[model samples]
Target: MNHPNMKKDQPVTLQTFKKGDKYHHKIVVEEAGYINDVIFRLGRETPGSYNGQQITVNYEEQGGALVGTVKYPAHNKVIHNTYEMDGQNLAKTSECEGVVHKRWYNKQQN
Candidate 1:
């Protein structure tokens, strides 16, 4: 949780989707390389929505801002993701499970 404006090797993109149990997630951010805006989070369990819900995604870059957390279990359950920018292992899809964390700021020592 250290987004002072977002700027530290900036370049992040994450996407996940499930159709049966219903679950979708997306996050993208890229500067100098184009496409620098996208944040969507949705969870469904039918009837009024937000049933077995858990969604939170936000991206605002120019200095700092990147957060993601989505979970929608069911359909036999078996979706776990953990990508701490190095501890990679994000490839599980039965329902949906995601986690992302990014924060950086260093303009000549602020």
Candidate 2:
């Protein structure tokens, strides 16, 4: 039951930080090891000091290689995508945005 899909020769490690002006964000998702779905609330706003922040995620792996964490003070690492899976089962995604092996089923229902 998952649909909002995206996959294609995956590999994404995005980073943005600008304190003085504006711009702050983080989206980390590693592959074949760990570190899945780690993100920061915001990274760029200029309308009302943009107030909405809540991000917490931690992970570690040595053998397969995938590590990402966030505890406030500082520490954010996990950006690498190179996908090559397939799709079926009503929206099973993972052609490359990292690992998502067989777990999707959205039969278009509202």
Candidate 3:
């Protein structure tokens, strides 16, 4: 559970939406500040999709990684995500059900 590659101050957000027959996942963070406020606000303001599933969201720290968990009880799905940020490089690992997904992203230099 300890992720030494992550940073404590930066929080990560993970989102999954089911469209058609597949679930699309997205993990993102704000470049300037934490994304907690924006994510919560959008979640509340956004209308539910056709799936009509209810989800519970929580946040915690695992080592230096910022962990986010979202539970979809209606579909018996739970996703746990931990993210690491090193300068402009971002990496995330998401576990849902029994599948694990890892990805790396590099921010474009401006």
Candidate 4:
């Protein structure tokens, strides 16, 4: 329904959600191609439930302007604190003894 070239910062990966309502967020940008930039490693239940000490991965596709990376759960390891987009989104966040996660990516530049 939405993919008119689908630009506007695209990084998506929020699988299986039903907490309240609004579901579906399984995006792995790159014009549906695939060339690195994909991650989603967090598992206390899911992304935010993984803890939350500031995790901001914005892929604003309502218009355009997105960057990636920002994770910190140091101890086991998951610290790449910040790297705004295409620095590789810091391994796709969520890994301090992760709990099954891996589905995130961003790609859209014109």
lDDT per residue for candidate 1 within 13-39, as digits (tens), equals 545444564434444454433232222
Clashes of each: 4, 11, 0, 2
Off by over 4 Å in 3: 1-52
Candidate 3, overall lDDT? 0.56
| Tens-digit lDDT track of model 2 for 1-110 | 11134345444343334466433443333442222233232321112111132334333333432233333323232223221223522322232235444333323233
Q: Each prediction's Cα RMSD?
A: 14.3, 14.6, 13.3, 13.2
lDDT of each: 0.34, 0.32, 0.56, 0.35
For candidate 4, the TM-score is: 0.20
User: Candidate 3, after superposition: displacement of residue 104 in Å?
Assistant: 1.6
Q: 44-96 in candidate 4: lDDT tens per residue?
A: 21233123243323222122222223343343344222122345432243323
Look at candidate 4 and give me any clashing residue pairs.
41-94, 68-85
TM of each candidate vs. truth: 0.21, 0.20, 0.48, 0.20
Q: Model 4: residues >4 Å from true position, as ranges?
A: 1-93
| Best-fitting candidate, scored by lDDT | 3
Ranking by lDDT: 3, 4, 1, 2
Lowest summed lDDT window (length 10), candidate 3: 41-50
Superposed by TM-score, candidate 3 places the C-alpha of residue 19 at a distance from the truth, in angstroms, of 30
